[model samples]
Target: MADKKIWQELCSMVHPGHVFQDEPLGKYTFTKTGGKADFLVFPESFEEVQKTVQYAVANDIPYTILGNGSNLIIKDGGIRGIVLILTKLTKISLQGSEITAQSGAAIIDVSRYALKAKLTGLEFACGIPGSVGGALYMNAGAYGGEIKDVLSRAVVLTKTGQLKHLEKEDLYFHYRKSSIAENGEIVLEGVFSLEPGDVQKIKARMDELTFLRESKQPLEYPSCGSVFKRPPGYFAGKLIQDSGLQGTQIGGVQVSTKHAGFMVNVGGGTATDYMNLIKHVQKTVKQKFGVDLETEVKIIGEDLKKQES
Candidate 1:
């Protein structure tokens, strides 16, 4: 009853169409899985976002951020409270060697825009499948390049509801992570420092990386890119493959035979299936090599209702 009241209040605050009830979670995730969300809130700008967050916080409603639904799993039973998606707020632009972007803009779009502007540093993100904010929050990287190499600063909304600009050092970007994980600061926008380059050469690099991604990844299927973080000495995929976990299936989810790093949904897989497979892989890998694997994918939402004692 309380949850429904909060949902109704939120709807009244935003446009009617922007707030949805019992929204199917399957349509939003990269893996094309999950059950449902209590409510999904679409806020189109910073002001809208602030209002929504303030309301949620004031009313003691749980809220979680959504970024293109990439590299995430929202559980089988769905999320409580509201899922805040800023995707509609996307914007991108450039000035000299600097690129400015709203948090909602696709990182790949930002990378491509930089390339078209004859900028070199962001070509590495041409194949990244998340939004600019998501990439920065994870310090997302591949092929020896990372967001740290290009990010100058970010406009962030702190947990206490203050907006501030944070420099690169403040973000504390490191291997596969950032302080955003610790502080829960929501990214609003960012600027990247780049350099002018030859268009032909930039295109050549982007083309080559695109080829590598297309030819190697099982993009034909739906899945989170890499299931586990690199385990220091050995690659996650290599470890999974060496453990004989490749081509393994639970429900419709299969550990990619092409790239052991990914767990693809060849058909209609649920978050439950994905979670079971992950557990199986982790147990097996731990037994075989005495090493515990940590997931790179962010898993959230409640699997069971909170019961009173």
Candidate 2:
């Protein structure tokens, strides 16, 4: 088949072992849902990523870059073309109150590294469950700090496979959104500038935030983190709770009783189930409060029905 030939060529670009065909995407996502990727490639280095992108562009094959998959939902029909997961690019280093992390480096690990270096600003990120790239793409934040507050610069690969360096000003960060998402840029690495602080104080702050996150979030089950963005003056969780949508279940997914904002996979949930539940919540909350709930989570891929068609 034509698809087989293209993926075989992809294997030549990345190592054959790292290239997978019809790879189930659920195994890599936080939600433990989704169907498959036609071709999944894990590139270990920046150059590998470049080659993959160039190839995809030249061949006119659609490609997507994924980091950690902490705040995403891929639909049930899986994705077509190449799906590049940057998990193998995990690398972190520090120099002169700055931390440089590869896109695949967990934002949580980067925060810990900052702590070890006696850095202060990233303490708020001590519990964010996302990759550095994902954090930058969405301007990820928790407690009182956000990626945009500390991000000095980022190296991104443009959709055309050109490498570009973007400063903080170039990113144009806003509440839970960034220029990266708008331009469809793939983050290769991020440099964060932090202030030097007392080690004991930094550790204490991280510990406090960690405790708050664990106590407030449903960490025991697989769930997409933070289903909806804050709607203007009101909190998404509070709106959902007031709507009395907690403990609502569709298929195997349930709105967490512990956290009104998170929808957890109690057992074998599907992307269809998640999507239907999200719509239900949005509709219910809108009907009750007259506030439109917007999702913070990114959903992609295709539907099984669409694929069959």
Candidate 3:
């Protein structure tokens, strides 16, 4: 937990009501299975984010940047220091064929917005559940289109709380990877350069992708979405399915029978259950096929055992 003096100073930086102490992180995550956050601040504007970050840096406090918590798992003991959740900073605008979205805005919503504006290129993101910030962080893609294909530039805050505008070439995007972390930059907004197209055509494509996603993904359960990255020449889900690991359960978490790629929290699942199940799947799959499955989901925080000790 943050010291009382530090907590008071943080609360003064933003809306006091937005500064939560010992906040339960599970309530914010898609998996609904994490622990608490020592300090969680929901900044409503870019300026607020800058101020909070500057305050943390000046005080020598560690801080973590959190998006919408869609593809993440927080551990049982929770995070120390401060966590800044950017969901409240959502805003989107359109100028000519270009669409600019604040980092916290949902990617799915941005895609729909693009379609509504008769834009063509963003149709592939119509069903993605992560925020624009999260998407840019991982260069998120689906159905053969990716952020790198349409992204013109991004506005980010450096570790020193200074804002920088970076062109697409500076991003260095790859499959589920970007230079965001290595550069210690916090994404503020994304500017996508799109083109005018037939709305009906775009809608049809989005609808088709949505149907395929609903049919193939385990959307009915609370999960972290696709658990592992696709290995070269092999699909993670297919390999796990071929290994006969579907319906496997560790505590209340289960490898979904619907989609082998997902591990769902059927009921009272914990982060430990999720971690254990992931290790088991990797071990089983590697032993069976000699292919190493690397996780795509971001897992953080401390375990209960370490916290108690």
Best by TM-score: 2
Ranking by TM-score: 2, 3, 1
- lDDT of candidates 1 onward, in order: 0.87, 0.95, 0.93
For candidate 2, what is the TM-score?
A: 0.99
* Residue 126 C-alpha lDDT in model 1: 91
- The candidate maximizing lDDT is 2
Backbone clashes in candidate 1 total 0
Residue-wise C-alpha lDDT for candidate 1, range 99-143, written one tens digit per residue: 999998999999889978889898899999999888988999987
- Order the candidate numbers by lDDT, best to worst: 2, 3, 1
Segments in model 3 whose C-alpha atoms lie over 4 Å from true places: none
Can you give the TM-score per candidate against the true fold?
A: 0.96, 0.99, 0.98
275 Cα displacement, candidate 3 (Å) = 0.5
Worst 10 residues of 3 by lDDT: 1-10
| Model 2 per-residue lDDT tens digits across residues 1-309 | 398798778888889999999999999999999889999999999999999999989989999999989999999999998999998999999999999999999999999999999998999998999999999999999997889999999999999899999999999999999999999999999999999999999999999999999999999999999999999999999999999999999999999999999999999999999999999999999999999999999999999999989
The superposed Cα distance between candidate 2 and the true structure at residue 179, in angstroms, equals 0.8
Error of 3 at 259 (Å): 0.8
Which parts of model 2 are misplaced by more than 4 Å? none
Clashing pairs in 1: none
